[model samples]
Target: MIYFLRNVDDKITQTNFRKALTIGEISGNVLMDLSVMADEVIGPLLCNPENQKGWPKIVQNDMKRHVNELRNLMHQLKGEMSSQIMLPMPEGVENIYHAEARLKESDSEDVDLYLKTNIEGAIIKWAQQIYDLLQEDSYIAFKRTKFPLPISDIEFYTHRLRNLEGIYSQLRDPRVKRMAHYLESTRSVYLACFKSMLTNVVAALLREVCNLVIQQCTNSVDPMSIFQGDADEQLIKLRKAMGVLNHFIDTYEMNRDKVHTFFPPGVMPVRWSFDFDRVFMRFNTFMKRLKMIDNIVEATVEILKLEKVEFSGLRGKILSTECIKVLEEYTLIYQNLGNITYDPADPEDTRFLSDYDKHMAVLEDVDRRLASLFSQGLDECHDLEHFFKFFQIIGDLYHRPIIKNELKPKVAKLLDFMHSNLDAVKEIFDEEMAKLNPKGVERPMVDPYLPPYDMNRLNRAISWYNAIREGSHETEVALIEKEISAIDHLLGRGVEELTWNDDFTEWMAEVYAAINTLQERVLTAQNNVRRGLSNIAAWGDKPLHNRKDNPEKLELLAVNERHPRLVARRNKILQSHAEFLHILKDNYKLFFNIKEDEESDDEEEELEEVDESTMDEDERLARAQKLQAIMEQWEAKRIAREERERERAEIAQAKFERREARRLKREAKEAEKRERQARRDEG
Candidate 1:
């Protein structure tokens, strides 16, 4: 019952013309014949099949059908290879019809072999060409780090790798024989190589891009230099770098089609032998490197934030203290006077004293305090300049958000401190005046014997009693002046020296300079700190400050008209030179070149583009020639002007030399005359 010697009878039975041949029987015959061949030829000829000497009609028919199927399968595989490998598109897809037509022309049984070899070779060649194109495009696109979605493009390439699996399936089919298998094996080898190459290229591109950005951001510390006059050079360097980067990115985009033309397969087979956990661990490490870079940028911004607040707070405190001291001292002079008339015997009167006593006792205390405070503040504020500049660099690297929560309390505390000191000084002055003069006397009737102004001694005593009274309001100069004048009339109109020997004018100069410096420093610190705080606040997942709209600062327009607390400071600096404000203003312009918005002049009319069809060759040539002539003339004029300027400068130098020579001659003549006079006197 066992089937034996099965070649003749089995082949006839498996034939579609006689017995109803099942797919299994046909497959069995192909494999049995495959086992009979020599081992080397078995694999190669089955893969290629051109070496087969003879074939049954059924096998020949089966080979023909397999050939067509392979042609279709290989085409699909080629597409997958192109896309997965990111290979360049070939000029035209190979036509299956032409391949089949060539196959039919040959009557030889090796026709299948011939067709498979040619098709397989063509597909491999096409894949390689596409891969080369992809490499070229990648090299150009290497500079374009931000390619909308390079990962997505890579994923597309991966998808093609997945489709390429179909070609592998066709190669493994028993019916394809050795020749077809050879083509499939070649494709498999190439796919393995391409997958590895692509993975490397993608990793390299990512690492290179990330590293470049990190280096650019990390090394950029001196932002102030950007605003300096030397910015042009740095700007040029940056622009060049950006242009180079842009060029690479443009190349990447332009060549993307060519790279994707091969539609290479996705789903590269992971090596079965490799450890999954180890691969994942390496991946995690790479991810952490990116995150660490971000954290470093954040930490830098925080450092800047701390520096801004610390320096600003210190500077603000010093300024507020100095301003209050000066104001209190200036108010004291008037408050010390009991009344307008100064009487020597009157207990409340201080006006009878000369400049030495009045200024020394009353104003010296205020002046000295302010000067000391100013000196200390100036030194401290100067020291902080370096710190602020250091932090400014950190601010530029990380755009720190301004958080209002941190700044509100600090600004409020500063304002409150200034107001409290001012109130305290005023209250003290009022209290001192109240104690000096007490009101206890009844109203006095006008008497003929008394002097018209209240110079009477008894009247002075009564006035003093009335002047030394307590009141809620501040003791101003007008109130104290009257009391002093009354005392002076009572005693005699003689002046005596006062103990207050204060150089107020000099003290004021110091106070003003200190306040100005302090205010400027505080304001700068506030700006930098606020900028950082706002950046932080904005960066958070949730906001901490009030988001509702508030009224705009309408009163800012009147800031210029507000009281001048630091005018004396500016005046002190400018006192030695006329137009000091102008000089400072000019110098400020030179140091800080603030750009102003200006209206662009549009006087020139736009020239209409000439129509090429309307213009003759002669006319175009003439226009071009004229333009060249004009450019030449303009260049010549520029050169001539430069020469003339040089000549004029030489002439001016010669004139200056002549004037100096004349002055020297006149000086010599004067010396000779003096010598003659001395000789005459001696004779």
Candidate 2:
């Protein structure tokens, strides 16, 4: 180290280096004394001066070796010193921010100054990283890292801050000033983040306490059932929340100083918008109000002269009908309480409110809950039974003296719907009674064996009246519920109930007598037809026993002119059967669920090819008239089709004749031209 030092001193003291250091550069040779520029000096051997010294070869070789060693040592010293300017960053990691170097008080002034000069680039890079990260994460990253800060020691506080203190440059050049600009901006951002985090901590506590208040109020459950929260768990949550808040306040007081020490003067606020006192006061107010509600509830039980009240929730919510009863009693008290005697002389004594005012306040709060619940509840009522019951319970409460005036319109609205349904049921009952199928001369035959009344429609009305009968709604609503039920018992029994009525029984008896007479006649006719159809094949009809006889369609019997009496007997049987079927069709109408096929007559006649010779005059004349009309229609259609075809042929012939004339004329023109050309050629 001494040898390197001696050589560096020796080289700087050379004549040319001395001249450059003292005399720098001179323009016009006048400012040689004032110029600050320095020029580099060349060695004599490189310049090859004319009068340079000529040393021995061994001596020159020794000087060159030591000079090369001195140069290498100086270069190594520069590399070592420059690397310490920034902290030793982990490999592959960008040197954004890290632990500050352990700068010692014993560091020489020049050493400190040298390090300060080299630190500008590192500080600039770190500031740029903070700026970009803050912008990218919208300062959320900084808040997570540095805000709501822990009670860390001074060592943790000092991390990444050494370069920003007083060590960095404050120059006008952008390179140096740019570092200061960014760092100053970053400090402002950090200060804001610290304030926001501290304030947010208190805000979160206040919000939690406010939520406890709401949960306490939302615990009410009554006829309206505005809130149905679990009571026991809510009570536990209230105490737990208070305990947590007390513990948080104690912890904040304990760490108050530590927090201030962690963030020095500019990074922390002296006074904040939110504080420990404000959060604690909000919690304290909630507890006080809770006690007030307790007092009001106890007073209410005493005033109503009721049995020992059992509390279900913080709010005066009860599960049974007595809750509504208490509200009813409270209504009476509320009216008397309105005549409060305030001190006349001490008008400023408005500080004390009577128990009546407190009760009214609670009821007003409940009134708001009812209004909200009713608006949503009435819209959800779909069933008639439920609508009446709901109105009986909740609507009656709403119509109380205290709550009535405010909720009168809603009560009237629901009653309108109720009256409309009642009117509709009455209408349905009247319409269905009119369908009794009265025993008159015309249209007396109802669906046979079915009830003369529309039992389904009558039962619908009966069931509706039953539904409305259960609940005691406030409004004066009466219906024919009892009368409708009696009518139902009489008429809606079953289809067989129709015979119990005298008019219907008499009509049914007459129908039965007529049907019995028709049945006797039909049996006689069928028996006669069957008896005549029997062929005495063993002896009476010996020809029918012939081996060659075929019964295919009975045509062989018809062809046997020798059996005229046989044909005549068969014809009489067929005619008699036809008369029997006609009698059945003309005399009776039945309760068939559907109509007979409308084309049955046409189809039967189509199949009635009963050897047209057998058809009587009436059937034969009708058939002949029908067949004649059909033939006339077909002949007229055929004539029209022939006329259309004839017209089309005439048009086609005219076209053909025109085409032939044009062809003949063109052929004549071609022949004449050919002859004229032949004559010209001969010439």
Candidate 3:
């Protein structure tokens, strides 16, 4: 069964290749036919003596008629040939108007020169290639290398032919114009016919190859399935073929560009020589080798699966052979091209080496460029994988990871959508909040729900929520709806809680009313206290301000011992009160745990002194004496403390200086020892 499947698959791939081969064959044959007909029959007829004699009379009608037929055929073939490949089709690939114009050269168009140069060789090969393409293993001679036919040469020819468009447009002669018109018509017909054939051939071949590969892969399960089975070979082959296909696609595009233009290049004939013939051959060889390797790999894989086939070194050996070698060889080839150097100071050397170095540099540059491209592709693949991993993470949040593996991407996409439009959600909430009103009545202005007790913790929670919402898990529509509903509910509650309303207005009003009442009472009481204090002065019955006389002069020569004593007592009390308030109020919470109620009691039980209105002369004298003593003691203590602090600082500085000196001395000794050791060694 496996053999049958593999055979069937191979047949399909071969069939498709054969179809492409046939298209190339048929197109090649038609060109050959036209050339032969033009050369042997048409040219001879037009040039013959007897025919020439009668030609002038019948020329107008007969020439047009004859040309029309050829034109029609050419167009048909060109059309047929273009439709085979799964790539962009360039303009006029099937058109031969340009080719015919070259032959007649009735006009001085440069395309005529290009066509004349190429037509003979082109026709000759076209005729020859039909049979060759039919051969099972025939290859074309491209750059001295015999690569597979159709695959190798066709693209190159297409490129050359398409590049001839520019030359085609400049022709002005009636005969050349007629020929162009005729060729175009024929090209269209040819293209249409060829495309159908190519499409069929390619489709059939790929189908066959895929089937064969699949079979080989399956068959490799049995150890004794095939005598020399190697499954790894199959995988390698598949990869190679895939690579070649990629290369071919690129080359095809390059050729297509040439074909799409009307006025392409005057020197197309010469430039065409540089067509990707080698690339195409390599591609073909790679394709064939890949398919063959894929078969081997698949077969071996199957065998290994069945009863432990001891196939080890046999696998990757062949796959690894040319890849590394090719990479290295290509690298060396580019490197030998030249080294690149540029210096602002060396103009002469720079000038001589510029172009050569530039070209060589391109070769070297391509290595990094290619490596970068490879890395970029890998990075893209990795990014895609990471995207999928993120999707899996999101999936884990909602559904089982294993089950949601396929849907993870979908969920991730949903999260991305939500995140992208999060502002919209905020906008909606803002609109909802704006609808609330606040006016009239007394109540607490402060909110009951405090700011999130911990901002960092809140922010972290928000981040987690945002991550969940923005993640890439394949969330079910229902689940997303539910989440959205939940968010809406929270948003609504948040808006209601935050928005100012009737209750908030009432609370604010009440607070303001109470504050106004307290403020009025405080102002009245302060006025009364000020008045009472103003009426009773420490200087006795007279107002204190009126009684004061030359206070500064009195301060300078104060002979009244009581006055000085009183001033000292006043200053000490003020200083102690200020210090006590500072020490208690600043970082007060760290001190004793005096509750608000206990604090009130303590304030009530604090000492009371005689009022300024009730002071006696003897009592004042006694108080002044006590104050003087206290002031002297405090002054002496303060001076002593300052002296101690200064001494301590000086000691610290001395210690630092001594340590530094010792370190310097030790360093000097080490240096001296090293110098002495060096001298001894020298001796």
Candidate 4:
């Protein structure tokens, strides 16, 4: 009955076949609808015959066959609709089978279109399904395919096309042959576009990587500047670029066999040709550059070591200006090189962990050289003048940590030495004064009077201190004052068991006060002596009767009677005064010339001396005039000496006052700064 139905369907007239075509299309739709219902509802119902025993086996079988026939008709109708060729037919014929038969008698265009619509449509549909499977997830193409799957999309499509070609080979239809050709050509075009896009993307990434490598080589400074961020940033960027290139290579390698096939013969030797090898080659180049930088740093450190050796002999020797300049230049270069940080874990870094010591040695050398220069400066210092110059040089290098740490203690030691010498000198002066004055003898309280012993003692002490003060620079003086102030602060902490040596500030202050007291006493003594001389001259001019009634005058006359004990006391006073003046002349030559002026005048006066009895009258008068002129010259010299002493004393007093004022002001400023700092810390 199915064969009879097929014959009737094929033999239908044009009008009748047209009606049959409409009915067939409607019937195919109805069967499709039923096939869905059967799977969703009817098949489940039939699974248990007891549930729907009304439907017999024959009835179910017939319905299944009808569904299959309807599916075949739908496939045929799809092929006919896709055809661009109009299949020739007899007049008024509408049957699709007859139209197809007429089309078989046509030329290649019609044959080609008919075969493409009929067979190639199915091939295209199958190729599209494979394409969709390969691109299931856009981000991960074909990554989750089953075992034995095609390696890439193009390969998978090629395999499916081969199977379709084999199936169509059995048919003699030229249309089927053309459809196979069309499908193969379309697959080739699709694969070409895909490979081109992949190549472009890979080429662009390679270019970017190459550019980054160039930038790393050209723009980066030496490794020393890496710590400042420039070289390090460039290296990090290079590393990231390398990472991207590595990822692309990994992706390409995964599908290498399939994707590489897209390239025509003789175009690429293999998948690992220019594209793959170039990336790794550039990576190797970057690694070599990094190693080169490491070597450069190591060599720089070695050069610095050589410089250190050259300056090593300069230790303990007096530093000339040229020596200082050389040391300064070496230190600056060492500092610039010392800033480099090495990473031992990096493959390209040739600097091993053990080599870090070599780098540190360079830094140590800088410290050693600076410290040696400071030590040499100190060793060469002898007097206050030299000490001031040395201290200024040290101050210039004070900004270096090594100089501050190493040289400050040396400076402190020098100060201790000076302080000890000062104490010894002061002690000698005191002992001499004690010897001159008897055990129980008190200093006289009379106005404007200084004992001869006290004057001699003061003269020695003043000369010593004045020499020190005159030789020192102002800044050195200030440094001494700062040290003294620090000692005072420590003592003020109220620590009871302090050593005398630690109380240097107090000792220095006491010594200064003594000198000031002696200066005042000297001035007072000068005034008192001048007043006494004036009184004696006035008394000597008065009449004897006027002086005889005055008890004060009688006492003064007895004291000046040239009695033996009074005469001895007067001679002792004169001897002590002469000895004190001699000490001033010897020790304080920078300030005094008393002995020199006296000796010169005395020699000149002796030359002018002559006896009046041994010469004529005219020669005797000339000799008297010469003697008067010599006495006047002596008087003039004595007056100039006194004026010079007075001027020196005044200048010393003014200098002391200015130094004291500055010290007080500096102390006040320091206290205020400390207070502000404390307040800020509290807040």
- Model 4 bad stretches (over 4 Å): 1-318, 321-356, 383-391, 394-406, 413-683
Descending-lDDT candidate ranking: 4, 2, 3, 1
Q: How high is each candidate's TM-score?
A: 0.17, 0.17, 0.19, 0.18
lDDT of 2 by residue, 579-654 (tens): 6566444323221111243223223333235678888999889988988876676666568668868997996687
RMSD of 4: 41.8
* Model 4: per-residue Cα lDDT over 171-285, one tens digit each: 2245433333443443433343333333433443454455454445445443435423333354564455446545655765677757777788888534533355444555555
**Best lDDT goes to which candidate?**
4
Please give the lDDT score at residue 609 for candidate 4.
50
**In the order shown, what is each candidate's alpha-carbon RMSD?**
34.5, 37.0, 37.3, 41.8
**TM-score, model 2 to reference:** 0.17
Query: What is the C-alpha local distance difference test score of each model?
Result: 0.41, 0.43, 0.42, 0.49
- Cα lDDT, model 3, residue 250: 72
Instruction: Look at candidate 4 and tell me the lDDT of residue 120.
Output: 34
Candidate 3 at residue 639, lDDT? 81
Q: Which regions of candidate 2 deviate over 4 angstroms?
A: 1-228, 257-683
